[model samples]
Target: MSTSSHHRPRDLRLDFFRGLGMFIIFVAHVPENSWTLWIPARFGFSDATEIFVFCSGMASAIAFGAAFRRHGWWIGFARTAFRVWQVYWAHIALFMVTVALLLVFDRINPSVEYTERLYVIPFFEDTASAFLGLMTLTYVPNYFDILPMYLVILAMMPFVIALARISEAVALAGIGILWLFATSGYLNLPAEPWSDREWFFNPFAWQLVFFTGFAFMSGWLKPPPVNRWLIGLAIAILVVTVPFAHRWGWQNAEWIFEARDLVWGGLEKTDFGVLRYVHFLALAYVAWVAAGEGGRRLAGGGAWGRFVAITRKVGQQSLAIFLTGMVLAQVMGMVLDLIGRNMLTWALVNLSGFLILIATAYGVAWFKSQPWRKPSAAEASGSRSGAQGRAEPVSRRSELAAGE
Candidate 1:
């Protein structure tokens, strides 16, 4: 195991999973003045949100588990809560920066297109309100986005982490119930009405995959010692389900759409439809198996390995890198819109945008490595104590009042 893994360092596989998720995000969200849609759909890998959110739960479990083990729940919970808040603020800053950029550009050069206008209005107007609503759990913004769910996970982290520590079965059961209810639409989450998002991710429905990942870390779901037969079975299942899903009438099931739209049927972008879930799990299995067997050779370790190494670094500082990627992707889209390209030019621009996004993430990761001064003894002790204080369970009344 890597030294970082000893400290219960972040999972490299999880980082790789998140990196893969961002690639799908680019595919789904990248502006389409031309083609590039059919291929993502044909493979049934287009909708990336479900996979991303599922992985988030798993990553949270691993990260918090390490913290919980090292320092009691109080310190562990405090650190996790603080990190979530950091991500929240980072998201807010990203939203504001994009809005500010769009507004400035609009003033300099007005346009007939609604894309930039749509983007700008969300940040300056309703999106501002939406952020506020999210903090209170009263509203969710961008039904297609993960911010709301992310915040909810943050709020519930104490209970969730505690449960994971006690019994993996209990955690799995809790997630399963949430998944069942959300997918069934049994529990209606009153998101903001104006958004009218066809449910990008009903957390209740997707929790199964997430918690299953947690099980993986807790020794509950070990990769069955990779037998050739099992590998064959997994691949066979994928081959059978994917094409069957595409051809059979099952692809467009209403039960799944009712729960969430992205993955139920065909390869739609945002909603968490059933087919999408199948495809995500299939890919995840393949990745896991490959990694288990020194497939590190396939990914490379020379210059290319160095590059993958960079991704791991960015993975280490994921919160900062993710926000940077989002902002950069949006900015790149705006630039392309301004260029007013022909078909060939548009294709090249799209490709360029994708490369730039990847490169920028690499750059941010590289930058984060610079050495910094260590905290003094007293400062470190005080910081540690503060974290412990936050971790301590508050009175039931305090928890209730905070929620209110």
Candidate 2:
């Protein structure tokens, strides 16, 4: 229950699923990638966004919540604030790199307006106000809204933790109230100054998903029992809803989309619509059941196990990979746009993106391992004798792998 217990084992499934979500998110972000047609979003009401927010909340609970319990409230809030600061800088970096690259490409290919495509032009057009808004987060573009929403939630973690200290019901009630206000369209931060629009991922609405994961991981809620009936219902929810979500069905049978909108009161992703929540929980349950205890399905010695471990690495250093993935996705989108999207181009871009993400994960892991630090005599001898990264202390490795 305490971060002082440094050797605590992590459930590999968390990293595995979160890493898988990162990869899927990469696929989803690239503009017009054919592979995107088959992503979870296309098959159900929810997508990798759910996977990300939910898993991130669980990771936060594991990393921050336990610390709060052991070290006290202020320390836990400090850790969360530090993470928010890191993510804030990462967001700025993501935007800068993306805009710079797009401008460079646009200069070369005068026929294409890449900046306009992603809505980066407004910043250049009105640098004074737009830059101020960007810095203040008053003009959050659609593509760059994720971090703003994320940091807002991180800023609220202390309140939730403080509430849980008093009573779990009070914390849950707080979360529910926000969800109600936001989903009802009464609560949200303004995204841009031009007219009237709210943040794409409304923190108030999305906190429901985040806190659900937090509650489970913090032991506020028990894991659902694995029963045949539960599994059946989850499967049915996934299977029966596919046609309504699939691109082919939307093209061939338009009513499915309309029906979906009607059934969920609009299925609006911005507000974290009802059907999306249910569908994501069902999918998450099925995945949780399949991973089994201690991620037995993903842990073991073999080819598949090794691949699973690699994916978990990607998940462990998710923030770096996510930033890299977003920028790389835009690069791949430019490549695809120039070359045109055929089956071969799609496969190459998607596979190369995945490899780059994997490499990013390992690279970030090496950096987080803090190679600049001095080593023990045994480590020094091993280093002189051709040893590499494997010499890092077990606890440090566990800590890095458990949280990003």
Candidate 3:
């Protein structure tokens, strides 16, 4: 089951897929773009949330798992805790910026409707309570909940790694129990200022998928060989499900059982239902078979290589780019609201937003690449002195996404 021998210096595939998920998220979040019709969610049971969460788990395993192995518990815990802190602040910053943007837009364009949505309405009516909730991780606005969910996951990494050290089976069983509890409504995490509501992405249930990714990447769980039959079945499910996903097909076939009815009362995104999780597993398997090596090759010439480079850069700076996209998406929504929602407006906003993301990625990549200054002789001597007593710096491949 060991995959250490199979590990690459860097998995470009992780970066490429994660960056692609970011793009999908940006497009999908745009209020009413025609382009959204073609995103993965329309064709299958899972969407970018699945991709993002799962990849993040894998990345976390690569990052924090390695630290635990090399630096022992304290250092690993510190690193994981540091990341949780980063994500916590990023979430708060995004919330404040989003609220400011909406308030300013509402003030400037008095006639334009902006804060009337269910999620936005709360902030305007009860600023004090909402602000309190935001500080407490309970007032997550729409499109702003994922980071908080991820923060919870990162906060648990030390415990997960500790349990895995005793026995991988034990760690997985614990994770499974929690997932079941969440899925069955036996466990719930409450949201403040909205006592009746819970987190949109229930970390309790979703942690199973996240831990699955982490375990697989950390060699605690080996991915089964790709099965042709399974692949065919997955493809068949996707094909059969597509018609139900579209307006034309749903309109034409009233006789067929509704897609939601086919699965035990349909898959629920918040709970990460059984069908939804299974679909993502199937999709991930097929994607692995199809792109694992091909992606590596692509990373190495030509147009595809260039594409891979850009995405890898974005993936490397995932936190910054994701936060930027969240803010930009809101701004784009305002523009569309003011100009009217036409194909031209949608195209302009989406295209401009996407380009901004790519540019941000390139900018981060350039910044990380800069050699600010060589250490002075005394500083170099101090560094060498310190190296003898500590673990080596974490490799770039093992560095988790900043906010992950």
Query: Which candidate number has the best TM-score?
Result: 2
All candidates' TM-scores?
Answer: 0.72, 0.90, 0.86
Candidate 3, residue 271: lDDT: 80
What ranking emerges by lDDT with the best candidate at the front?
A: 2, 3, 1
lDDT of candidate 3?
Answer: 0.79
Reference-based TM-score, model 2:
0.90
lDDT of 1: 0.58
lDDT of each: 0.58, 0.86, 0.79
Q: lDDT tens string, model 3, 1-404?
A: 12342365336677777898888888887766777988889877789999888888888877788888889999999999999999999988887788778778888778865666425777768889888888897787756789988989888779988888899999999999998889988776667666778888888888888988888888888766657887788677767767765556767886543645666424788888887887788788777766744354545588877888888777777888898888888788878878998779888999898899999988877788774676878999999878854644554334655536
Deviating ranges (above 4 Å) for candidate 3: 247-252, 255-259, 262-266, 292-297, 374-404
On a 0 to 1 TM-score scale, where does candidate 1 land against the true structure? 0.72
Model 2 pairs in collision: none
Best-first order by TM-score: 2, 3, 1
> Clashes in model 3: which pairs?
none
Q: How many clashes would you count in candidate 3?
A: 0
Judging by lDDT, tell me the better candidate of 1 and 3: 3
Error of 1 at 317 (Å): 3.4
